[model samples]
Target: MRKHHAQQLYDYHVWANDKFFARLKELPEDIYIQEIQSVFPSIAETLVHMYMVDTIWLGVMKGNSMAEIQASIASVQEITKDNQLQKMEKLFQDLSAEYQTFLHHESDLDKEISPEHPQFGRLDTQLSELVQHVVNHGTYHRGNLSAMIRQQGYASVANDYVFYLYEGKAEK
Candidate 1:
């Protein structure tokens, strides 16, 4: 089912993340940190936004309240790259773990779970939808971050999911 693709995407997503961060680290730190993009404002902001969406989506999937989700996002925002790569890796790991858990524990991926999204209002979603949400959301903001790197005169790695799958190995 969708869980198979979800499992594959977990690997792809993390590979892309490692590639993105490697490119970031390769860039001159000052330019990497200073190059500002309107969409994300800064590379740091883009990274934080990715983790925020993770928290938001993961919380909802865990049956946590919107209020609790917001708190999770706030805490994620405080995590700077230097401050928490180990922790970030764990969150990325959890993304895969949680997805697997939901796949097994739930009787059906199509079952509607309508949870109140604080900003989006009522959202009737499937487990599949949440998996899709994180993949699509991560890809979008990672693109923003990649563009920022290119704008700063750096070559960005291929972060497309297809690219990641075809490559079959994480870079760095």
Candidate 2:
């Protein structure tokens, strides 16, 4: 079957995240947890935030209740307590695989969902839109991650969508 627009964007999101995480792992190990005065305290903390949000959204997409979502987030928090970048990367990869499986089996990309949030009130949107929001959220934080790396005088990887496209073509 042909891919939906949201699925394509999600694919790009996973590819881009993998690229950034791989580059992050290549840097000095300390760099991952190095204290920084930014939106987040450190790269490790920022990654944890990214991972938590992704987990929350995935739970939401799967029709999980708020309690279940909170549980999922708490579980991830436990994993991040050690501040290990490798563990964080593995979490991302595992979550990405889950999303891949979800998208693969999802038959209705536009199915309407009403998920109420404590702060944002309620969102009445389609599954596809929620997927898009997740991708956008990831992109925004990846930018923050890139800047954090630069602030520490480290080079950041290029994870633009066009690069993902180019790499796909090159691999064929």
Clash list (residue pairs), candidate 1? none
lDDT of each model, Cα atoms only? 0.69, 0.88
lDDT of 1 by residue, 1-172 (tens): 3345554565576678878766666667675447474597777667766877776777887778878887876776665445344455566666656755765676665567888865779887776678677878888888887788788777888888777757755433
Over 4 Å off, model 1: 1-3, 80-110, 169-172
Candidate 2, which ten residues in sequence have the lowest lDDT sum? 163-172
- The CA lDDT at 19 in model 2 is 85
Tens digits of per-residue lDDT for model 2, 12-32: 998888888899878998888
Reference-based TM-score of each model: 0.78, 0.93
Summed over model 2, clashes come to: 0
